[model samples]
Target: MNRRETRDAVVHFGPDADWVREAAAESSAVAAADGVASYDEPEADAGAADAAGARLAVCELSPDAGVEALAAVRDALPTVPVLAVVADADAVDDALAAGAADVLVRRDGVDDTALLARRMEGVAATPAESRLGAESTAQLLDAIDDSFYALDADGAIRRWNDSFSRLTGYEDEELAGMDALELFAGADRERIAGAIETVVETGSATAKAELVARDGETTPVEFTGALVTDADGSPSGIVGIGRSLTERREREARLARLRQAVETIVDRAPLTLFEVEADGTVSTVRGETLPERLGRRVSEGDAAEGVFADQPEMRRHVAAALDGEPAHGLVEVGDSTLEAWLQPALDETGRVTRAVGLALDVTEREERAVMLDQIQASAGEVIWISTPGKESMDFVSDAYEDVWGRAPETLRSDPMSFVEAIHPDDRERVEAALTEQREDPDAYEETYRVVRPDGEVRWVHDQSSGVYEDGELTRIVGIATDITVRRRRERELRLKNRAVETAPVGVAIHETAESAGPITYVNEAFASVTGYDGDAVAGEGLSALAGDDTDSDRLHAVASAVKTGDRGSATLVLYRADGTPFWGRVDVAPVVDGDGEATHAVSFVQDVTESKEHEQEIERHLTEFGEVLAEDLGVPLREARDRLDAATDDDPDADLRRAEESVERAVSLVEDLATVHSFSVEPRRLSESMRGSSPAPAGRDE
Candidate 1:
């Protein structure tokens, strides 16, 4: 037959036994090739076998009888490529092992016998070159890194590469005739077997399994299997390739562990942590148990579009972060406040893919800050904090209005404004003190002046401490107290002391000791009288000025009396520094204490030297005057007495008459002189004695 006619001469083997009817229609124009006569059943099988050396047989096995029937068919026609037709694809593997060259799984609306005959013709026409070419292809596959295997229809291994042996830890001798199911680990055996059956039935399957090696080590593997078709275009067996997934699975497990560890840390932290996706969908909320509002999932629409949302500022910040800008702010969440920080998630191209949020609960800190502000507002002193520049104040307390006569907000704008309010005279001193305090933080005190709005000046005492960050001065925080009243009181006391220092008179002060002794404090007058400077006897005992002849007992008694609030006077001999003596009357009085105790003594002394001399002169004058008066009387009376003696003895009469005039005159003159002398002498003597005796011993009533 010609090439084209020969294609038509090959009868597609589907019509039951109507060969004559087909041949009569074709005529002899295309002669049919002499081949085989076919029969449908066992009764005509002998004739069909006699006509052609080989008999075409079609067999269908029940799901249970499939394997046994295939085996019997293989013994009957060992050389024929039996095309076994099966209802299910699962029987294809057993059929191929029983010497069936190909298999066809029945599908709806398909002529199986005709389809098989066409496929056979196409196979027969192909040269042996294709088979040899397939051998070379298998060799190339063996060179790859992956394990490859082909199982026969009997579920037995047909061919495999060296990689299979290496991967399974099996030698060629042990694996050549073994069942492929033996390579599966116990956990994967049933799964692998089921996959093989699926591939046989469906012509393709895929499975991942843990496979066991000859040494009992397990490795994760992925298997991709396909049915190997025969000449009749029917499934004959399964060919599978395995790839070791050990490294891939290990990577996945490590990633899982890392994620778990991160979650654990975030959950245990006191601060909140969260993640936002590209669309602003929040996920992965973790922290100390927080309010439900914080834990709720937030979407872009919820943040950007919703009204009555409390965290509008936070939402704006997060939106900015998604746009590749970082933002941080304070916001109030459900039941707590937080300081929220938003960062951008970057992709490989350095573009922001999403935003991640990290929130810290700062509720307690905010509350404390508010309370501190209230306390500062109520303080009586001005409180402030300054930066290292010393040129500005960041925070100033409200009490600045009372202490510095300026609003706290004014100082906050310009810290130097407070400095300008200082009194010009005190400005330099205040600056020096502040500079010194800054240099040595331990020197924390400063005094300065502040001029009020009413033009009154006030003294301010500032106590401060340096705040250091990284060994650099960051700020100075301190308080300023108004000390103007205290300073005024101090000035008044100084003026009063000056008045007491210059007082007149020899006023000496004695300090009473705990042991009832006395120490002297002499003023300038006391120093002049004692011929010693005030410093010379400052701490000396009061008795140090007395001489050995001085009446010590009387002096002690006077001191004791004076200490008990009784005034005393004494005519005592005082010893000078040169060991000379002087008699003077001294008066002592108590310096009473607050509790009415005589804790000190004060003595006022005056010199009586001139007065004592005047008294002595007066006494001598009186004595001379008395003597002259007696003598004059005696002389005058002698004349009168001689005349009066003759009259009183004879002069009582004649001397009374002639001497009566002389005698009377003599008596009158004598009486006048006597009276004058007596008056002068008596007054002078009494005055001198009284001046000397006015002082008595201590404790005496005078």
Candidate 2:
């Protein structure tokens, strides 16, 4: 047996039991070899176990003495490890049932003393392990929130608590009997091993290192270890408590980010920081040269009182802060406005210790607000603001009363009443816009008519947008503009357009350009006169109307005048849709904008074909009349000359008189021919009369 001496072990036996002394002496020799100084007590009774410095008890029971002696020893030294030495094998069961750590039998082939010593050494290890295996140790380990593990001297994991499994993701089956150092990596493994060694060598040690989990992820952990000892005060193993640092590190990082943000704000903003003591005194004052205000009570007479004079409720805020509530308010100090926020400082026990206050200069903000109010008053449009989805107006400028002709107070009291005032035809559209604004809260724009209390209808162009806080719609601000004049002009234009469309004269409007402008629109009359549809000529140049007999020069003149934004006329024969030609007059004028730029050209076309035919007839009639007159005068002259030649010898007065008569007769006939009723007589009779022959009478001429 490999053994060394340890503490003395108590042996309880009868006076006749001398073999125990021999066994004790041999066991001491074995224990001493194992580095334990063991002393054997042979005559010690069960009651004297503590006096003997007993680490374990060896009970001797004779076969006839029964197991009663072993039971008695067990009852006396219940905590001490016991080995029952029995000569009869049958008594082994009884000795074990009496709470013996083991049973040693004295047999013939076995060296009884050596066998008893070996069994005693086995029992020596039992007392300490038995105490640890008690329910209380497990309860104590499991009660802790942090992880715990026990490792043997060989660095093998022996026991682990529930938290160990949760933290490292290693169940009992996976971690049992594995090397505990395998849970770490790189220098962390070496460091943790060294820490465990230090704990074993000394009493305890603490270390911080990273530990690996099942998925090969490492977590920083704080480890505290202490050496575990047996009842004999010999080092056994290490029991360590390990706490994960993940949440702690995350919390620290979050706090660092918040501090950085606050620092950035403080650096950029004009602010004063003050610390208020629990007794309502300002202990520290920073920023804005307020050093003299420190250690002063925040009351009526203090320097801070002037700053908070406008905010009388500040006293209640301070009281609330001291009672563990946060507060904030705005106040005016001198000519400057300041916004103040106060937070309670809490101690470990959650009691309010003090208050930290930050005050920011808001003078610029106040000035801007005042400037906005002035802008609203000076603006011509109606300026209004309201809470989103609420039927009440928060603010409306003076223009509201002028535009809607209703008192602002009434609209403010019932905002929906404004919707009721909307023209019935436009009310549904306006309500729909309001609903859409409430749902999406984006910029809203709509033009609708409103009916005033005076029964005058006015058109309003409303444009609005939502105010948001944290991505939620909070309020709506908008402007309403009167577009009534523009709408009235539009109506007048529509009526004018209708009149032009149905006019008697053919009207065609053309686009104005540097060259011949394109025809854009043609009235129904123009279509009827041309036999060509509007679509055929629209976008076509004015030359599209010219055909075979069209007077190109006159058409060019008209087109040039229209393109140059002037009025011009052209009388030319234009071809009809069926290839027939007729005389037409085209009058073109330019349409110009306020900038005097010609945007369009309008032309009026008149068909003067009948008048032109009548003029041709008149010219023909005049030509015929001249031919008739010439013939009548020529015959008279001929006859008169013949009479003069034949009667040369006769009286000259007589021949002259004859010529005079012919001349007078020709004059009379010309006069009668010139009469309006001359065309009613026969053309031959007129010819005969002009021949200087008497009328043959109507029947004879026929």
Steric collisions counted per model: 12, 15
Could you tell me which 10 consecutive residues in candidate 2 have the lowest summed lDDT?
30-39
Question: TM-score of the candidate numbered 1?
Answer: 0.40
Question: Cα lDDT of model 2 overall?
Answer: 0.70
Off by over 4 Å in 1: 1-385, 391-403, 444-446, 461-472, 477-481, 513-517, 548-558, 561-573, 583-702
In candidate 1, what are the lDDT values of residues 562-626, reduced to their tens digit? 45556777766566666555455567788787898777777766555446546656766876777
RMSD (Å) of each candidate, 1 decimal: 18.0, 19.8
What candidate 2 gets wrong by more than 4 Å, as runs, is 1-375, 440-447, 467-470, 532-534, 539-541, 595-599, 624-702
Q: What is the C-alpha RMSD, rounded to one decimal, of candidate 2?
A: 19.8
Model 2, C-alpha of 180: deviation from truth (Å): 32
User: Model 2: per-residue lDDT, tens digit, 150-174?
Assistant: 8887889988778888888887899
